[model samples]
Target: MTRTRVPALGAEGWFTLDAETPALLGDRCTACGSYAFPPAGSFCRNPRCASTAFATVPLSRRGKVWSYTDAQYAPPSPYVAPQEGHVPFCIAAVELAEEGLVVLGQVVAGVTVDDLQVGTEVEVVLDTLFSDEDHDHLIWKWRPVAAGGAG
Candidate 1:
């Protein structure tokens, strides 16, 4: 049986999956130039800017680690553990310098907090978060930037 590749239901409109280099989709406030993730809302989030227009845009694919930690325990409801059961993973808070935004994501599989540092550079990548008989639920993850700047 073939399983379909699909983004997690809650993540729709937050990213693009078909591009060679997939990117997170965000919305920039037309008035203030500030960006927001998940791309939802009719008005700008900036308190000083009253303008309501925004344009969907792709966010930076790379950023520096602002912080990171190990998740030794499984998450609560709505999170499905892998077939082998819960395995420890690392979570990172990466700061996109261009947007001045910090995004949180799981570290790519096989990488642990021991391999990362506060300022380590990382890039976004898509991977299976979990799977069902019919689908592989994909989600964004962070991986240390390879030498020479390739993601």
Candidate 2:
């Protein structure tokens, strides 16, 4: 049996999976150079800038851990829980250097609180969220940067 891969949630153009290197996508205000993830549909988020034009840009693949926590309970609707019930998972907020913004996402599987710390470097990677007999949902996740460097 073969399982089809799909995005766990609705497509919002926040990231691209078809590219050779998957990357989180963002929008940059042409005027102020401010960036926003999930791609800002209109207007610059910078209060000082009046420009509404933006260009799609790929966000930094690497970042430093700003904070982290574990979810011990199942999340609310739209988030499909595992068939076995809630499983605690680590979540991390990483600060991107060039983007100058913090992005939050789930840490890759097998990573625990003991394996991370503030200032630890991490990189984005694709991982399976959950799967039914016919489909496997893929989602972006963060993993600790290896000793050799970014992977």
Candidate 3:
């Protein structure tokens, strides 16, 4: 499911992994042709230029696993683990083409640590981190990529 509200940091547009919207989000520097995810809220990190105006750019959904690990124990405050049962979640860092940067997120449903390895191939997937009675916090996650021959 895609998040409906506009992103708060760099991009003014909302994010989604729905078939209709299957791109990661980043801010493109109008000054330079660089992009940053989670939107570079502060300023462009590129050392070569000093520009402020940023445009929302769609990122590639598929990437190769740069590295991975799992949270053996529940994370502390701010991370609200489900109350019903403690489920260990796998998080991965994926490296995209052209960007040369690594994006980190959780593995999707039906995936586990046992299924992951460094340099594995992965694709971005949108999933809910949690939902209260009122709203759901949607986030981008990674999973084994089908085309990469992941098994």
Candidate 4:
């Protein structure tokens, strides 16, 4: 049976799934040229800039790992564990090459904290966060750029 793919609710405008490559949709300040993910709206996040105008732009795909950790405990409600139950997952803070901003996300499955190090090159990709009978809920994940980099 075929399942429909959908972004995890609340992730609609935060990323693009139509491109040859998946990209996070960020916003560039029209006045001071600053950038923010989750698309900074209403006002520029830059404290020095008072501009409220922004242009939606695709963010860079590659970055270097800034920090990482593992979630050994399952989160509270609203989070759905897989069929295998609550397994630990790695989380990484990656500094986007062009934006100079560190964005946090879950590392791809099968990768452990021991496999990552600060400065490790990584890239963003869309992955299934969870699956229901009719849909595959998706979200962005970080993966090491090198071959066999996952642990």
RMSD of 2: 2.7
Model 4 off-target regions past 4 Å?
148-151
Ranking by lDDT: 4, 1, 2, 3
Distance from true location, Cα of 56 in model 1, Å? 0.8
The number of the candidate with the highest TM-score is 1
lDDT of each residue in 1-151, candidate 2, tens digit only: 9998777775447777753467788999998899998787788878899998999998999999999998888888788765677778899999999999899999876778988999999988776777888988778888898632332
Q: Give per-model TM-scores.
A: 0.92, 0.86, 0.81, 0.90
Worst 10 residues of 3 by lDDT: 5-14
Count steric clashes of candidate 1. Answer: 0
The CA-based lDDT of model 4 is what?
0.86
Q: Model 2 scores what on Cα lDDT? A: 0.83
lDDT of 1 by residue, 11-108 (tens): 97788895457888899998899998867578888889997899999899999999999889988878887657788999999999988899999988
Pairs clashing in candidate 3?
Answer: none
| Alpha-carbon runs more than 4 Å astray in model 1 | 147-151
Error of 1 at 91 (Å): 0.3
State in Å the error of residue 70, model 4: 0.6
What tens-digit string does per-residue lDDT give for candidate 3 at 78-111? 6776455678888998988877679888887667
How far in Å is the alpha carbon of 102 misplaced in model 2? 0.2
Ranking by TM-score: 1, 4, 2, 3
Candidate 3 deviation (Cα RMSD): 4.2
